[model samples]
Target: MESAFSGHIYRQNGQGVTSILSRRVEGRLMWKQRIIGLHLRSKIDHSYLSQSQHADTKGKSVETALHSLVGHIEKANQYGDFTMVAFMDIEGAFNNVDPMADVEAL
Candidate 1:
């Protein structure tokens, strides 16, 4: 069986609103996740990004990425062979694919 997570909530004094969706992992899971995070971080390809991908590093926001992408597209258009630029964000798409849907609908 897999481990489960617990949710935590916190709020300030005199405030009626509370923060939800905060997770506090157990001790065992925390250690396990740390080890996994270290391994994954080490395996990242530092050279996979080219000079054109200026905002593709860690901690980059979507706004910065859009700025970089727009600049690159504009530069490419000057060559007279550019058609269109397609963008896809596939990070969390797997969860939203709805795998439980009826297969026959395909």
Candidate 2:
């Protein structure tokens, strides 16, 4: 169920152009992302990221999240505290990205 972009570039004239990237360029981009992920992981706390988003975090699923939530809810109930949860579905969350900004930040 992995979704990937087909590297298609669209023009103002409504023409679609397929951009083919060489393996070398693709590998370099992947390596850069992996390095960035490693650096971020070292600087940030692991708990701040969703388990599935990182590489080192394995054997974690939605069930694990639910179990943790239920345990916290039970503890809160024992202490007479209220628990609330919010869910958000954002469409096209990753569809827009400025590559120049990312390169500059790096």
Candidate 3:
């Protein structure tokens, strides 16, 4: 079955208008996504690659990141040490994933 999609433009705060890709994603693609999402979450939740609260499980979000940062800063300050933060630019990071490699990993 073919489903129609309605694209809309919306403005955020004072930002200029942005086009949003609206569509009814369903069928096999949706099911695959749901399954993969759950698997990814499970693998990430208990992995060392995930931070204390940055783990992708429930109740973890920006607030979690903020709390972790605050805790680190507090601990460092208490020890009379300086803390430095470095942010990485990961725009289009997904482009680095190779399709065949992804299939192999899956």
Error of 2 at 71 (Å): 1.4
| Total colliding residue pairs, candidate 1 | 0
Q: Tens-digit lDDT track for model 2 on 1-106?
A: 7648555454343455433455456788778767765764465566776643523555766677678778889999999999998756577553345544554565
The list of candidate 2 runs beyond 4 A from truth reads 1-57, 99-106
TM-score of each predicted structure versus truth: 0.37, 0.39, 0.51
TM-score of predicted model 3? 0.51
Where does model 3 exceed 4 Å of error? 1-35, 42-55, 95-100
Error of 2 at 105 (Å): 3.5
Model 1 error, position 45 (Å): 4.3
Judge candidate 1 against the unseen true structure and give its global Cα lDDT, from 0 to 1: 0.58
What value does the lDDT take at residue 74 in candidate 2?
A: 96
lDDT for every model? 0.58, 0.63, 0.63
Which model, 2 or 3, shows the larger TM-score? 3
Q: 58 in model 2: Cα distance from truth in Å?
A: 3.8
Alpha carbon lDDT at 22, candidate 3: 30
Each candidate: RMSD:
9.3, 10.4, 6.4
